[model samples]
Target: MHVQGVDGAEESNDGSFVDLRRSQAGAFTRTQAMRCGISDKVLGRGVRARQLQRIHPGVYVDFTGPLPWETRVWCALLACGPGTALTGPTALRKYGVDGDWRDDRIHLAVPHTRRLDRKSSVVVSRHRDLPAILHRTRRPLTVRIEVALLLTAGAHRDVSRRAAVLLDACRQRRTTPHRILAELPALPSLAGRSTLRRILADASDGVQSFLEHAYLRRVERAHGLPHARRQVRATTEQGVVYRDTEYEPYGVIVELDGQAGHADSISRWRDMTRDNAAATSGKVTLRFGYQLVSDPCSAAIQVAAALQHRGWPGRPRRCSPACRL
Candidate 1:
């Protein structure tokens, strides 16, 4: 005979706990064994068949058949006892991590002090309460991977914070360049603080972040475009001088016009001489400088005409108004 508090909520037949598992449903009191038509003996029988998975001491699922990974996370959470959340990789996948969410075993948050029995499918990690910087909703999306990143970000500085700030902001905003200032944990290290400031200042609201916004801004400007940063390397041609923006895409070799590259002639000469040696063969070259791209229209028009000349598609998307292509 189960000595239990008789919760008055209506229970469905076959003892399937209905009010549980829904994100926002719960009754304050217990259920009566007699009212639910479930006896202690019958409850024990269901528990053994791998049907009713017990989440914790009190809660049990009267499983009809199989459960999904996310459902397993919820059930594991229920079994792991109270005050638990499925925060981190679990949350991030829902937020936008861009991969298969079901591939991971469900992650659950127990107290920092609790020792959970590890199972094959479930991976457990200890966590203190989330920092004041990280807020929570009724969302169980944090998942295990990102929560670990946030923990590393707390230490501040190093590649992790640089990587974390960008990643966390992306997760939080579903976009890049989230206001990283508010979320910075209080870090006392001077280098760490300075790094945080640099990282935040550099964060971009652009369509992309990993592309280095400042560098892209420089490239996108209506001014002296340099070699397409990492993509193309340039050198001075003995017979011809071309602007950095001008590229022969087929044989990609950039032309470095040192005279107008920067005001510092001595430093400019040094850079150009080095660039000349670097562009041997086997590389596409882009050649452009201050004056060529200073007028944005000139640069775009030149590029389009050149690409079309090279049989690249220069035509705009042609669509009748009715079709909306």
Candidate 2:
């Protein structure tokens, strides 16, 4: 039976073979070649002639040069058989989120019942409800941004990395927390739903970094502190400033200092000026560093005191048995 070649032309099938090889990053499967009207004899001949390199049982790579990482992802998709698409960090990376994570194995999501052997360069994640989780992108085969972030949270081992994925995906991809939250009910299998929910809640409140997120979870939410407005913007002579978390009703602002210190003179001046501006506006600012954020109990106590001092009638409840409220 004559098969449809890469190019639509019939007589020029030979030329189309070459075009197809080049189009797919010099990688194709035996099935693809056969479907393209290329005979097994031609495939064998190409491999024997050193023009094609067998990268997997049925997959061949054109010996053009070093195979790019993206091409490898494509090859992994092909090798995983049909009904497979890129997911997790592999998909999120394309959306410009979490550049620091590097995994050698390409992440693919396939139907749950589709049993497949593992490949050295591929990691297969089975989703029982893949059809619901998958999203059609320009590539036509990728998990949605929220799905990718959720899967990534499961795949990553580090707590900070897990936390950062949510914040970074929202900030970098310009996706809203509400958009992510909307996907939760439809998600069939969730690895860390509570953590994801917390991150989404923090994101909705404008928590930006991992540390700030920790403060929101550990200090504020845990101890039942007053809900604070996050990333509150104010115009200042130095420039516009965003308060990390603000208790506007009580006129209290909480600033979370990152791991990196504001040692530079200009940054220090800007911070001082921002604090002065808040004070001038009759708002008191409470700043916490990495150490304080780590000790959530103490941070909550301080915040409770600050709110109470500002006429908050409610007392902060103990977050744990050991927490001295």
Candidate 3:
């Protein structure tokens, strides 16, 4: 990307602004910086004038960068090499995986065979399929995990939502099968794949993903209403309905509202039509989004009510206004 000079002034030919303006082959290393005659004083000037922003060791970005923090993110990936990607939470933030959630680190995943240096802000890792996640977007290419997940999107919204949470959890370093399973209900309308089940199985322990599996599990999975099948195929007049969750003979369908359901025009229409069809049937469907699954109380209340309507008892009653936490 081109550089923006002081107050939108055109760039000067002087060597001083050259480093800050040029397209980098990769993340700048200490050795390269020293060779190019970059000093702490010059870096300080760049920072003051907003010409450059530092990220992970010697990596820096020019004010004229293409994407926000793009330079540093690319730098981390290039410096780490071909097998590396800005995975987990770093990828989530970079790719807008979760809107408005500020993360504190640059998570880089390398091949298990690669070695890394001790660097703050850059959390390097390894994976057998690190290359699977990176993709080129806009002018510069970006490494994305979700793109890989979307490669085969047949699992439905519930699966995708869980995968996003699972991705977040892996980014946050909170990886566990049970926890990932717990977080799954919160991601509404998210398409899923068998790949997601594999991703959950391979969660990391010390490295951050993008979510908190512990929180999701304790609140959702542990006390969640039981359903025999996570995804059930129901052949109704509405064509073919892929039910991610079911309340059995009572016909309680819990749909996970995902990004596509809310964002994509076709998906939204399909969802609306499906909901209308569901209502026409004897089925009672309670739809929950990311927030409801995160808490599950609203979902629980609705599920319990549906069950009660079908003669199931001993369920927790709704909390009184004063007793609400």
Candidate 4:
């Protein structure tokens, strides 16, 4: 028996079928096609004719070959049924968060009360407040960037990894610490809530990366070093440059190099030129990489030494039993 059309008219007469397919990146659920007045026999014919590609059981795409990222996303949503939204890193990427947030599996969230079957390359989660977090007006349906950040952050077991998610979201200008802070009350049971709050506070203070957050907490605060100004803007021969951490009164600047290395010869030269310009302006630049920052005590010692040499009277305090400072 043919499924009844949604508007009591065949999709062919109304053009809803084509419109629905286009809106979902050429992917549509079998149920969706049926609601548009397409039959099982018609779908079988389309599949046999190589005009439709089955993605996940009921999900079908108009094109064959490798599926595009957008098509994969649509297929996941269609397979999950209604009220499902893109969540975690998948949602963050949709909101334009740059860097390493991409996932091979499409992450989705539905209302906690609904139980859905699993699909390949799809991770489905249940959220009690899914409706509140979901962006209803947006296509492909996604959780708000703030909620997505929190969800993504909560999924990580490591505190640093969680901090990285929140920081990268803000650093890339996809979301703000304040917006994320506003969404925190909705997820009171989120993992590492206290740590998440602290990181958000640090982000509000212009700490833009996990490395910067680590430096602020482990090195500066732990060692009783003066709080350094973060993202300090300075006009130099290289034009405008922002220093990661600046002790302006002490004439000392700390540059946290998060890159594995100078990415290229141009990056190396740019760094060298910036340091030289700082030197010419009588400012001392202390560079620290991930390895150096891993030992917070050592990093603090160096920073404290630089501050002391620039006429600060304070000495670095030992943070732990193993701390050499």
Which candidate ranks first by lDDT, i.e. highest?
4
Local lDDT at 254 for model 1: 34
Residue 272, candidate 2: alpha-carbon lDDT: 83
Model 4 gets an lDDT of 0.84
Order the numbered candidates by TM-score, best leading.
4, 2, 1, 3
Give me the overall lDDT of model 2: 0.78
Candidate 2: which pairs clash?
none
Each model's total of backbone clashes: 28, 0, 29, 0
Poorest 10 consecutive residues of model 3 by lDDT? Answer: 206-215
Instruction: Select the stronger candidate by lDDT from 2 and 4.
Output: 4
Better of 3 and 4 by TM-score: 4
Residue runs of model 3 more than 4 Å from their true location after superposition:
1-70, 74-88, 91-101, 108-164, 167-228, 236-239, 256-268, 289-298, 311-325
lDDT of each: 0.44, 0.78, 0.52, 0.84
Better of 1 and 2 by lDDT: 2
lDDT of 3 by residue, 136-235 (tens): 5532334444442332122235553544555553454433454544534433433553556555653432212222232134223444444334446667
Of candidate 1, the 10-residue stretch with the lowest lDDT total is: 24-33
Per-residue lDDT tens digits of candidate 4, residues 172-255?
A: 888789999999998877888888999999999999998988889999999999878999887886699788999999999999
Q: What is the TM-score of each candidate against the true structure?
A: 0.44, 0.79, 0.43, 0.91
